[model samples]
Target chain A: MAHIVFEQVTKQYDNGFVAVKDLNLEIGDDEFLVLVGPSGCGKTTSLRMLAGLESISRGSLYIDGQRVNEKSPRERDIAMVFQSYALYPHMSVFENMAFGLQLQGTAKPEIQQRVQAAAAQLGIEELLDRKPKQLSGGQRQRVAVGRAIVRDPSAFLMDEPLSNLDAKLRVQARAELTKLHKKLGTTFIYVTHDQVEAMTMGSRIAVMNQGILQQVDTPQNLYEHPNNMFVAGFMGSPAMNFFEATLTQTGEQMVIDAGALQLPVPEEVRSRYQSLLGTPLIFGIRPENIYNPEFAPPGINPVAIEATVSVVEMMGHEEIVYFALGDGHEFLARVDPRSRFTPGESVSVSFDMNRFHLFDKASEHVLVS
Target chain B: MQDASNIMRLLGAIAAIIVGSGGIIALFYVANLVVNRLPPRPRSQILPWVYMVPALVMLGAFLVLPTLRTILLSFMDRRSQGWVGLDNYIFAFTNADMLIAFRNNVLWLVLVTGVSVGLGLVIAVLVDRVKYEPLAKALIFLPMAISFVGASVIWRFMYAYQPPGTDQIGLLNAIAVALGYEPIGWLVNKSVNNFALIAIMIWLQTGFAMVLLSSAVKGIPKDVIEAARIDGASEFQIFWRITIPMISSTIVVVSTTIIVLVLKVFDIVFVMTGGNLDTDVIASRMIKEMFNFRNFGRGSAIAVVLLLAVIPVMVTNIRRFQQQEANR
Candidate 1:
């Protein structure tokens, strides 16, 4: 119901620690924008500032085009689910859900009806009279959510709401929250350190590091094209592998020379590297993009290289093979499980040249042609 | 012969010490042995009570027997030689001095309990947010370490009075003289004397209430308060709706404790004014009746009244504790 904007939002504590540095994010109405980062990355601080729980030190915040920097949380009409659930332990589940309505002076019957509706929506109708201490963790989590939804606020700000649940329940709750967001169609600004939750639930994930907003993009876009070394390494499991290499012109071809192995640039992209010849660069490739020569995918601009297998992890779907070059540069490859490979075996592997990435060695920014 | 008799006395004293302690152990050991030989079902049923025998016997002899004797003596004459029926009870309820004591006791109960707990809770909430919280709390709680008699003695000097023409030595009279007002006798003025005594008791009991209530307030989770704020509760609303209800159990505990203490308030009245000038309370009057007047039946009747007054408060406390246990 509200489109929240953070214009140069910065959170500087009294101890001189800047938690969030000039973060500017635009969350559209009904958008599920997740602020994701590692711990101490200021994601929760950002959400709290939006919820009016924390004061914005140096920025203007707007909800539906109206500046709300000075407004209290009640005036902002935002409901929040805390990481600890924060349900009133003394109140029964029904009373917990009815509290906000009662405070707003909503009629008693309407309060009861709305609470009942939210409880039914959460499939927690039987738990109305039970206190928070009497419920299981999952039930308490639902009650927290139900308490927020009963108020029907402009937006719902959840700070890692599912983190307390067990892994299986967390996954189930993740899907339920996504469905709830869609059903409610209210803007949700969720804060979590979990990459999987951000990738799965967020319409757009804003990745942050060291109080700086690194990138804000869709999950697929972030996976396919990260802006810098941190994003590239942080996005995928087992991470993308990097090699310190130099782009050298070997007559008609530009070959990346890393001393251990040399990879010839495919002719289609060779012209883009001609001007950068004799310059140092960092070459990167995803684990899934590397393959055993015998199981290499067709239509790839393949460049063959040789290495020794240092370790083999036999995952049922695929094997994660660790390879070491002659110069002792090691990298992981996700290859076909059926490929016969073992530790200490010399093998030929093919790199999908079309999928490789190059970055400036000094700046670490991805090179674009 | 004197040396020999001294050695014998020493030997007898050591033997008595050992025998007394050993006798208690042997009694419990023999009881456990006897219970063990019974059928398993009956043994299980009777084992706990067997262990409780010493305590129960002591309670019966010291508590139950005295209470029964007091009740019995209440219905007899001054010498406890003939039945007087309701004469002593009527005197307890209708006598002019006893009436003043009852009124004073009620005033103490309401004002002392109300002000101490209310002030304690308010101070607790305020200090919780201050930077020097521990220091402030320690200072506020220091008075609780003083016994009721000691606190009353301290306040006696505080409320000390002198004639207007004389140099004022008491803190209150000194302040009044500095302000150019005539020095007033705080404990002798019948209209305000009970209030003066009650203030001293409040000064002593407030600290006890504050310490307990402060801990209860600290036990409330921080995030819960934050959630309430986000749920549209103002600072005042949060205190009333969230804080008060959250620490209500502790409030009940502190209230009943202060109430019981107030009901048996004697030391302040006794030490400050000796129940003169309309400062008499139930406990102080009971003491005077039993020891000074030496009226056995009337004293017993007043003692029974004080016990009856305290029973309801104790019952409520027990019921609350039981409910808490059942919830757990």
Candidate 2:
């Protein structure tokens, strides 16, 4: 097991398209670092550079302190699981697992032993003689992982390994992959466009967009404290709601005056926005952070926003009430499932001011507390 | 209704029978007059008939009738005026030139087919992933565009002989002269002249093999290749272990095709040496016996032997193609 470091690494294709720009990351040993982005956002390209499939156009990469920028994939001692699963379609499961060992010139009996062991670990021992095409999607994915596991490489680079599986199987495989990572205790750099996979699977996620690294943090930290508007908008489901509001001082209390509504800001928010008092700022709040009046804590300064309910999505455990502000701005508020809110009805929703995020409208940077 | 009427009318016509029968008979005449003079059809269904009529007539006259006649001639004496009852077969078995030609044909079949296909496979794999791959393939495929007679003429110039005192203008001799070596008679040296003619056939046919095998090489899925690479297979291991196995069927098809072509090869040998100097293949010798010497019986025996030699390979090729289609 080894830590992987991408130090100012960049990848420029032969056609002069810059796929990854100055990517610098350090994944510690046994850490599952996920590179998450939308499609063509340089996540897979960065993972390929780490896997040594694509050449590093600028700067160097290191695995356990060894500079491997110019090394072939085999020489770098890394195992990769492709998004396609890429099992040798012609070989049996056992032969597929034994292929790498055989190439390394390992003894025949030893190769068999390792292959069987990896097969057993994957619970595919009965499928040892079956071709990849004969296996189901999940089994093929496991075989791909088994192929990498048998190598006992310094690190595992997976490029959206579970993307091909059906929804139920993807969930099952996600848990199994975490278990496998725990069991192997090897660095895994998984690239995926699915943010849920990144949040659930990665020990730390590096979210990227347009070939630029936006934010990298633990899943919880990233969710709670996204550094900028892009991160704030990208990380959460139903995304953070944003509205233009002026941070004004009203009788020594900082108040946010969004058109047709005004609310006293929390003391912590006031101090955070002290420098930007009377300046226009973007107010961001997650749907889950906003609630109905019954759940609002007493003595906590809550901002009451008047909105007309446009739609109510009745999820089993919670209700998502989409409301339109008078000025035509729309936002969703997660409320108790029993709340009887109807469309076209005006309601006052409590926005927990302490939990809301404020960003400088000009720079789009979060105004930190 | 009109289409059906027209088809029926065409099929039932008195002129159809006369024209068809005359076409068949005229194909046997030396001139190829009526066969080449057929008119083009306005419609596609009629077009197939227009093209197939000439081929059918030609096959009936040259291949079908001649094969039957050769079978009859095989049982006759040299003069064909008298029946000799397996006398020609006995003659073919005992005759030294006929036996030598048969043996040399077998050697040519093995060497030319095996070497050309093997070299083609190597060339296909080597240049398959090169940066200038199209350019390289075009260069290799260049020799295939040259007709067999043209290739023979080109090689003849290279193998041209000059006495020691005379100027060495031939390519091989000039190269030898440049290297300060004595000029050798490349085509008249009987021990190596067979190989020289075989080289021309190989040169002409290797390009066909390369083009076929190159397509097969490209047909291997990129995923399978990348999978093998990720399995830690070296480039050489991938080529041998993965690539060769994947394209094995194509290789067999190409090899059998070249073998069939080799069995029928006559132009290179005939043009280069006129089947002289220990270089007579079965087809060339059969032509020489029939046309030059007018020995129908011996020529028929050689023709039957060549047919027999080719039938099994053709059968195998057909079966392989059927199996490949079934697999698809």
Candidate 3:
């Protein structure tokens, strides 16, 4: 197993389109590094470049500190699991898993042992003689993974491997993949557009957008401290709400004037935004942080904002109330499921001031403590 | 009102059928009278006459009677009314010219069909990945548009001989002269005439093979190729191992098609060489014996042999087609 490093690697296509721009990442040995982003965000392109399927336009790629910019995929000793499960349809599962070893001229007995071991580990021992067409989607995916496993390469590159399966199968395979990674103890560089997969599986997640890496951190840290507005908005479901607010200092107290309501800033938040006093700032908050007045924690400052509920979506565990503040500003708040609220009802929602995130209005950079 | 109209339409249909049947019966009666006057019936107890009538009539008119007449004419002294058995077959199998024709035909079958299909497969695989593949294929397939006779005429000028002196008008002789060499006769040389004719047949057939194999190559799934590449197999190995096996049925079908054409090749050989200078194939020899020399029995024997040679290949082709369909 080896640590794979991309040292300011860049990929520019012949058509003059930049796919990845100065991507610098160091994936440590035996670590699971996930590259996550929306579609066309260059995550897959970066993975392909590391696999040597795509040519690196500039900068060096190193595996175990050896520069592999000029190496072929086979020469790099890396195996990839494609999104389509690109299995050899004509070959049985045994041959599919044994192909790379056979190409390397491994002895027949050794190939058999390795292939059988991989099949057993993948729980596909009974499926060794079956063709890929005879297997289900999940089974084919496992066979694809097994094909990579028998090689025992320095790193495993998976490009959205579980994206083709149904949701339940994807979830099961996700857990199984994590277990397999731990068992094998090899560095894995996985690429997917699914945020949840990255959040749940990776040792560290690299969020990318528009061919640029936005943030790289642990999933919990990413959730709590996104670096910019895009990362903040992209990382969450029922995403963080943003409102244009004016920061003002009145009598040694800092307050933000949201158009239809004025909210006094708590001391901790005030200190965090002390550098941006008197400057306009954007206030962001997660839906779960906004609560009904009865559920507000004691001794915490609550910024109560009154707005008419425009729509209420009753999820089984909670209710999401879409409320319209004046001047066409709208946001949602997750509240208790049993809360009595309806569309056209004016309700007082309290924002937990401790959880609110403040960002510079012009730069969109988070105003951090 | 609807019943009255339906009855009138039914009467009109019955009237038309009666008129058609009346005309057919009149014609059959006249034909029967004419047939009865020509021959008396043989009394056979076990053989059913009615069942054999239509088949006998057709065979006599088209095949059996014509064969008998040809055999008779082959034995007779050219006017035809005597009997001789095995004489025409003996003359056909023994003649030196006939032996040369047979040799030339075998050479044509092996060289023309073999080289064209081989070259076609290589070209198909090479250009399958090229940009503007459709345009390349159309250019290659353009020659198939020229009729065999037309192609023969076109190449005749190309193979035209111009001896040692004077400005060469033929394209090939011009190149020879320009290269400071004596222009040799391409089609008239006994040693090279067969090759020249084979070249014409190859020109006509390679396009057919390319079109067939190209479609077969395209039908191989992209994922299979990617899988083979990711397996660390080189490009050449992938071609031989994955591509050839996948398109084996198409190769068989195309090879059989060219074989059939090779067996019946006549137009290019006849138009270019007129069975002269060691260029005679089976079809050309059949034409020479039957029409040019009026050797009917020998020609018919050659025709039968050619048919016998082609039947097995045709049967295999049909079975291969059925197997392909069943696979689908």
Candidate 4:
């Protein structure tokens, strides 16, 4: 319903501890934007400041083109689902959802109608008479969402609403929440420390670390085109392998001179990175990009490197082959399920240089996004 | 003679209750007849109060009648022959000994309630999850098992003082002597003795406050408070609007309980100081005026004043209980 804009927003505590710093993000209207990071990464602080729960120490926040820096939370017309679900323990589930509407002085009949409708929508019609203590955790979370939905706010601010649920329930609730967001068509700003949740839920994720914004991009873009070393290493499982290598001009092509092996820079990106020739850079590649020479994709322009397989994790669909080059830097390659490579076996692993990632040695900033 | 009158009063009270119930049933029948003029549902609401007539009548006899009689007696002459109007009240408030009693009662009310509740809250918050929390709480709560008269008697010996040159017999004075200080007279010193008695009340009542408030404090989940903050409640707003409302019944129960007990405080003062050397309080003063001096008018006035002081707190406690029931 509303596009949220954070223009250099900073949240510094009164004790001079900065929770969030110089955040500049534009969340599109009706977008499910997830702010994901480790604990103390300021994702929750950013969400809190957006909800007007915490004050923005600097900069401004615009919701639907209105600067809401000085507005109280009630004045901002946003509904929030807390990690604890924050139901009025004294009230019945019906009254718990009706509370905000009641506080706004909505008519009793209208409040009842909306609450009943929301409860029915959430499949909690039977729970309407129950107090929060009488319900299970998943039911409480559903009621929390139902409470937010009943108000029909301009946006929904969720601060780790699913983290308290058990793993299976969290997964089920994640899909339910996505469906709810689509049904409401309201902007959903969710904050969490779970990367998997962020990847599964967010239309666009803003990754933060130590009070600093690291990257803001789609899940696919974040995995494919990380803007810095931190983002590249943080997004993928079995994370991208890195090596300290220098770029060199070799007979009409550019290649990285690793200590004991030479990795060719792909022709498509060689010219683009020619200016950094002979300069030290970090060579990076995803585990999925490396394949056994025999199992390499038909047209991937694979560069073969001889390495000994140190470990092989057979994942049914594919094999995760842990191998090491002569210089002793270990790497993981996701090869075909049919691969017969075993530990201590020398195999030719193919690097798909088309998906190569590079970062500046000193700055750790990505050479290409 | 006292036992004979007590039995006679018991027979009189039974006869009054029988007559009272009959009168209440008659009153309710008439009220029901009048309310029957209204619509059925509205009459239904009003009819419940008709069912309460028995209770109201009993309250009128046992509570309201005695309160009215006390007020009436507060204005009468000592011999119950002529009206003295405000003379008894004036004497109750203006007399030197009576003023000292009022001052001492005020000191008891302020210090006893504040220290007990304050220390109770501190201990409750700090003792949770400690290694021997139940043992510690039980130890602190043990004083409540002792009757006020017994507690005062025990504390009286503890506060016993001797001259500096003599070996101290009391625990406090003995400690002082061992610590190489002069053995000060704890009970004989007016200011010190009043506080000494006040400390016993605090020691006795703090357990009551702790047992109730601690449970209330424990009932508040951390996440709920966080939710309030996110729900737009400021820290102060959360404390005042949410936290206070959630535990208000407990707070009211504890406060009014201690307030009512302080209003009628007599046993401790009588046992420890015998209403002497600036230790006189309203209830003790009333008893002394009525018995030792045989000044019934002044004593009735003091009793009336104490009843007046306790009424609001009692009403508040009843209201809190009613509100809690309403919520349920």
Q: What is the TM-score of each candidate against the true structure?
A: 0.87, 0.85, 0.80, 0.64
Please tell me what DockQ candidate 2 reaches. Answer: 0.38
- C-alpha lDDT of residue A35 in model 4: 93
Q: Whole-model Cα lDDT per candidate?
A: 0.91, 0.85, 0.85, 0.86
Model 4 chain B poorest ten-residue lDDT run: B226-235
Q: In CAPRI terms, where does candidate 2 land?
A: acceptable
Query: What would the DockQ be for model 4?
Result: 0.18
lDDT of 4 at B128: 67
Candidate 1, chain A: TM-score against the reference: 0.95
- Model no. 3, DockQ: 0.29
Instruction: Quote the lDDT for A117 in model 1.
Output: 96
Per-prediction tally of clashes: 0, 0, 0, 0
**Distance from true location, Cα of A153 in model 2, Å:** 1.5
Best by lDDT: 1
DockQ of each: 0.68, 0.38, 0.29, 0.18
What is the per-residue lDDT of model 1 for residues B1-328, given as tens digits with 9 covering 90 to 100? 9999999999999999999989989999999999999999999999999989898998999999999999999998878999999999999999999999999999999999999999999999999999999899889889889998899889889988878888887999899899989888899998789889889878888888999999999999988998999999999999999999999988998999999999988988899999998889988988898889888999999999999999999998888888878876
- Candidate 1 lDDT by residue in tens digits, A1-53: 99999999999999999999999999999999988888999999999999888
Off by over 4 Å in 4: B1-219, B229-241, B248-328
Models sorted by TM-score, best on top: 1, 2, 3, 4
Give the runs in model 2 whose Cα sits over 4 Å from its true position: A244-246, A257-264, A278-280, A291-302, A308-323, A332-348, B1-94, B326-328
